[model samples]
Target chain A: MTKVVLLGPQRHVPTVRSALDDLGVDGPVAVVTAGWEEREREVGELSEHLGCETRNLKLFSRSEKALDKDPELLDALRALNDRMRTLQEHYRLRLAHTMGAVRELVARRGAQEGALLEEEIEHALGAVHVLDQHHTRRTADALGTFDERYKPTERESIGRARGKVKRDLSPCAALLVAGGHVAVLATRLRLFVIDQLIEERPVVAWSAGAMAVTDQIVLFHDSPPQGRGFAEVLTDGMGLCPHLVALPHARHRLLLDDPSRVSVMARRFQPASCLALDERSRATWDGKRWTLGAGTRWLGPDGTLHEEAVPA
Target chain B: MSLAIHEFLANGTPTPEQIDAFLADRTIPIVEGPEVTFLYRGEAAEVSLQHWIYGLESSREFTRVEGTDLWWIVAEIPPKSRVEYKLGVIHADGRRELVRDALNDQLAHDPFGSNSVAAGEGYERPDWTLPDDDARPGTLEQRRIQSEALGQRREITVYLPARYRRSRRYPLLVVHDGPDYLVFSSLKTVLDNLIHRLEIPPMIVALTASNDRLHEYADDERHGRFIAEELVPAMEQRYPLVGRPDARCLMGASFGAVASLSTAWRHPGVFGRLLLQSGSFAFTDIGSSNPRGPLFEPVVRFMNAFREAPGKPAEKLFISCGTYESLIYENRSLVPRLQEAGMTVRYVEARDGHNWENWRDRLRAGLSWLFPGPLWMVYE
Candidate 1:
């Protein structure tokens, strides 16, 4: 188990330096900014914040080189991505309809058709749950097929990159993961199995980084540009920190004031705690239980934010 | 009845001193609820408000305050409405001139010039349209391509999203009237903000301008060939695009909208999405001659023919028009026809004029629906 410190978005009010200070991590820090994609190499500010020598692992660049060197692997990755996209579209189509029905039925729950409304709501909600599970399973299957067929880690190019990453990460006091495109970040990390290499090194990650370390990656937005954004499971995370759905930029991304939506989200991802990790919020995992920072809260089942810590 | 202007004229028509005091501290176009009182002060034989609000008189004479130079007119505008207008002043010397509002500095610009903007109650510019310090900006590179179809070299402005990588392939958005969109509509800033917020995916946007905008964009055969046969191939070669019809979008406003539709119609599956804003889709369902003038002859002919057999221009379309535009009927008519032809259409109508700002406000709705970002699903 790794000791992970998850913080909110660092764009506005940066709490990374303080988080690092609290952890007493002052030596050389290795940073994985794969999420920043093209800007992965620009880590001057982050390094300065740490006030220590930084080893930029450059996982994004390394992945690019590995894929470039191996055309077969690149083609496989592309094909897999295409399949995943189709699967997601299918999931979205069904989720939209199911969520609509649920919302309608829930709104009419107090009507004269009370028992019927409740029954229909349950059925619609059940369909939603099934759809999520099916999508998750299909995603895993597709990814598994690609991994099994290609054996990416065994490939010469990828193996070389992974070896270099492990060597680069060896001497760092702690790991710092900054946020950008979460999917890209997570994919690069998984390719090199950075989670495995981290071992017992304390990891201080924020935003998408915080999401990446969790057991599951749930994409949530109440008012997206398109239809009503019903929260959906994007993919399985690295599984470093368990039983937590890290919601970075919660206030901006979610409609916390709407109790119905909040209740659905909290209940949908049951057993796991939905942490609202807005700016200045922090949650520390000491490889056992969570120690939530002041003002840090989790979305309770009754649609309220509670200050109680969640057990891992 | 106690309007701010009424208060200014409470003690009969205001004297020069009282008028000076009234104009000193008060913001022009005094908006109180739905009533907007426009005021102009000058020596003129006649002063009229020339506005483009549909269902209202295009030109309304402002009443001269008795014994004073103040010309004032109170208009009942709905809340959240933004109106662009000019003052047509007929001088004492029998000369006439159209001028922007001297008292109101807020303006909306286009290719021709600019107009004074009067924002009604509850109207505020969307914060997302402005440049944000946090939103990392995309790069725009100007490139010239020799178009064999049009037999001319064309300048194209490409917008590469911030943190763009060669490793990742992006969707392609081809915009008609590129320079105008950048200068007038703030397209670059909008794209940057939307991408930063994950409201829309980070994609490559191609801004295409024409030498003869009216002729070329009015459903010219060569223009269609240039976009479909020449431009798409060149962009795909230079950049890493998804290279599928579904991943490509063609967008434009007014005549540019006609260009987008006709091009996509001509090349059936070239572009899978079309964003048509305030489309000048003038069609003669019954008549023989073009009533909108000689400039709209080609547009009318193309639109009429297309209405007969639209034949699925794209898989999805996001069409928007201002309720205050003459083309609203045509836009509203096109939606049903598109839906009937088995296309997913999202049509939005705003209570604004047929100006760049109206188009600007609708970009978020249009772009997001066509290519939604990873906010919902990022399967990585």
Candidate 2:
């Protein structure tokens, strides 16, 4: 069984380190800090926290290497990236309009609880949901086709890096993934096929790390300086951990008090719990149900927010 | 030069018996004066002082002591203030070295630092500001409101003064970059101390957190509308705040400062006082436009508008930028414009670079001038 536990962003305090120790995940650990991009190798503090040296899987550097070595692959990836951007921009424009309409109607002066308006919003939201899923699936399919055509694993640079990483992982007890840019992290993970490579190894991920481990990756920021506060489904994750949308720093970024926003998010991403993973909060999975840790909260579809029941 | 050497050094090749005496005399003293003295003991062909508070071009050539292996310099710093400085050493063959002060143990504490610190006698961190076991701290309550102007649900953290009464009306200060000012600048602590000492009037500070600080802080009229139309009215309804525009203030640092000033300018009579620190007021001699990212285009547009229009909205405006900041010339140019508009303006430049601490240090001056406490600036 792959025992995975997601924790909060470890800034000054190592929330993950303590979780690792409790779960008995001793080193030499394989650390995937590709999320941090260029600064992936700066693991001195991480190693100190874990009480062991970590073997780094510099997936970011290796990706750059592959791109540099193959012009064809780079061109393909760039074209795909450009297409994705165009699609995202288009989606954002429509989503902003829909969300804005919904918000205004809800806050309209003396506007009674109109089921018709609610239904209309639901329909609009349904369209948004379809578009989001379609985009995510479309991205996955595009990536899948490219992966099959290129057989990126067969490439010399990728092959060598994978082999080295796999070999390094042979002695490691578990994998520790740190967070950075979610898109970059997910791309690196998909490029390396981390889910396939470390199928049985116990893993611990946090922040965007945890987000990347989920089936669907959602990007959210409520009060962004320039745009409507609408959380968009970016793409698909590695599917290692499923059935939940991981929201790190939810307290900091999200307006949890707004019932309208919370209800929309919860209902929009149906079946999957909108799990908030703030600092000191943890969610462990032993290949089954989630064992909620202290400070963890989830937004219910009923428009109510629930906090994790800490054990006595 | 007759220099009163404050730093102690063990320069000579000491014998075993004299080693203890040498170690005993190595206590460096940072003398408090109008012109502070700095000492360093390092082997280098040439040494120059590179201070953090001073501009990049402020490389002072250090002179060697008459009979000892030490590089020393004394310069007139701001009478009562603390600043960070480093030594730039050059080898005989032309290799360069820039580092912290070796003799002085006092250093500025930062995540990315090693900059040596020097404090003047009258420039000590006030005792009341630091976290005290017995001090009555103000309460910070997080609140969220729907903002149609900005098309988002924004979070606002409000600081209520101790012994706050529902019956009593308080002055309102809307601080941009609310989180940074609260966390990094220790704004609440400063407010608590200032209020407790009656240095500044007891006020309610509403920290408006920005989502895309860069984009929104520029020339976005939506943000200004959000503050004036939505936020101010909301605050009025919720808190016992003085409804008059004169009792209201808008404050921020860097782009946050730009947004605050822009908002106050955009919404006339909404805010009386503007406290801007290290504002990123970029421009060239020719026009109010220059090279920056796409987001900064709005900044230029807003600046140009401000230049063309009359600046009669804000009654009292306080503009401060660091001497070490690249925006120094722009800030300097802005002061005259505000003054020409017949607006009461105060301009200050600190020795430190563009950072939060510089803004924090100037808060006392800004707030006191804007909202003076009982008997403040008034002789009985």
Candidate 3:
């Protein structure tokens, strides 16, 4: 049986524990986050509160210095910078000579000093013009060099992080919970684990995480006076369990004011089922049917439930 | 090749034909000057030199034996075409000196304080010293054990004011993009300097690392919960945290900026001060669809919710962005929206781009404005 649980935003650890216990899934869920250490520890405690196991699986960490400072890839960047400098110097000399001749002719003819001054001025101006053009071309070449160095290093980093998660997958039922930006990465990670490791793990996500498992992502950024909320159309999703669109924080007044907008969005996107879970609510998917659990209410268009048939 | 030509021209003496051959071969025409003029493709152009000297003086005398009138040389060249040549000057001592163009912008200052025509500005390389294993606040043994609980042991560097340990209690600031703040912005060093000068109040800064920074800094519950539930408790345990709403501040840039604001907006009791730089207040598609009640609308609603419910207004809110940043327009619009909602807002527009350079430059100003120092003293 497949089970889907929608937990509320900022729900107490006891509520999360009760939901997991009722599902009969055991301890030590793999926790993937990009939060600070103290935050990660609190998450660990939450797992402890629920009598479950927890593991950290984080991908990219921020660095204050340049990306090239990482010991693993610093030398290559330094070499590239060195080469870029050499090319620029070579061009500077070429431009100086091209402008020097004009400076001389104006001086030799016993001409007016004004005419000679203008010629010297033209020579200086010409030299600067050529140098600017050459500098722009060389800078583009330098950027390309940096890109060539970064690609492989990023892949290796992702591979090592994924390897740790795969090693932690247990023999029992597997449950994955992802939230916020982890949702987008989690979907990709889930696909990688399923495709390469040949594992069957049930996964769930909240907020951005939930949006990642669906067929598409609808961004809410409004530019300008309203906060920036731009909608995105995604082609790839985890597709672990098909046909349902999971909406977390459904009860957030900002999201739940009008059911018509959701229905219109649903129709335009065309998912088989639309499940809106508010804080402290659960929408369980047991393979065949999705049961909307207690905590919050889900209202469809026309002020009624949108389900084909309400689950017990 | 061009420099080689200039050096050849600078050689003390050359026959007129040698000079002519050089000019003609390069498709450059020579015009006698005082004022030499020409038309290139029908447009007139002119060139003139203010000074010119020819012929060397006697070996014992350091003077020009043959000098032309200062206005003697001038010529015309086509607009936008480049021309290069060198000057041959006979000094009073009968020696020649060749002067290259000194107007080159690419000239870099050398270590010995001389100017050199280098490709780019020669800068001293950054001496980046990784924190010593023991230099970190806690013990290495404890860090390793804590690392196991942390799952992935990414480095987290904290910033304490110079008088932090001596201070009875300090205000706390929880910020996202920890690594970037510490290293890129030199946040700790800035704080240290500021505190030493007594320019700003001594504060305990908890720089939290955001692994999946974008997702974690979204207007979602996970990020809010992480701060309110996990981050706060952990920091409070180790540090002498004031443990009051007004003393606690939250801050971040871009998406992290909005997350900080949202966290404080949602739970003003938990976070009272906000330093939002280039905040992403726009709506995103990942969360709920509340068309009538969009995220920004709710922020207004939340403000109203706070007002109608009657509570202390936020202690301080510092919002800022660079003038040239892409988010400038959006951020400008948000200021009035926040002000109208009754937030105690101090807005600043920086002249920069949307990167750490700008953020670092403004961190000191933002901090000082939010927490001003003692009244009487001025340090030079």
For lDDT, candidate 2 versus 3, the one ahead is 2
B-chain TM-score for every candidate: 0.97, 0.77, 0.55
A260-290 per-residue lDDT for model 1 (tens digits) = 7777777777678899989899999998899
Q: Scored by CA lDDT, what does every candidate get?
A: 0.89, 0.77, 0.49
**DockQ for every prediction shown:** 0.30, 0.01, 0.01
lDDT of 3 by residue, A82-155 (tens): 77557645653553354344335434445557776655645554554445445545654564555565643344
TM-score of each prediction:
0.84, 0.48, 0.33
Q: Distance from true position, residue B50, model 1, in Å?
A: 1.2
Q: Candidate 2 on B223-339: residue-level lDDT in tens?
A: 999999999999999999998989999999889988988998889888999899988776545665587666777787777778777568699988888776777887889988889
Model 2 docking grade: incorrect
When 1 and 3 are scored with TM-score, the better candidate is 1
Better of 1 and 2 by lDDT: 1
Q: Note the residue pairs that clash in candidate 2.
A: A225-B211, A225-B212, B53-B351
Residue clash pairs of candidate 1: none
lDDT per residue for candidate 1 within B303-352, as digits (tens), equals: 98999999988999999999999999999999999999899999999889
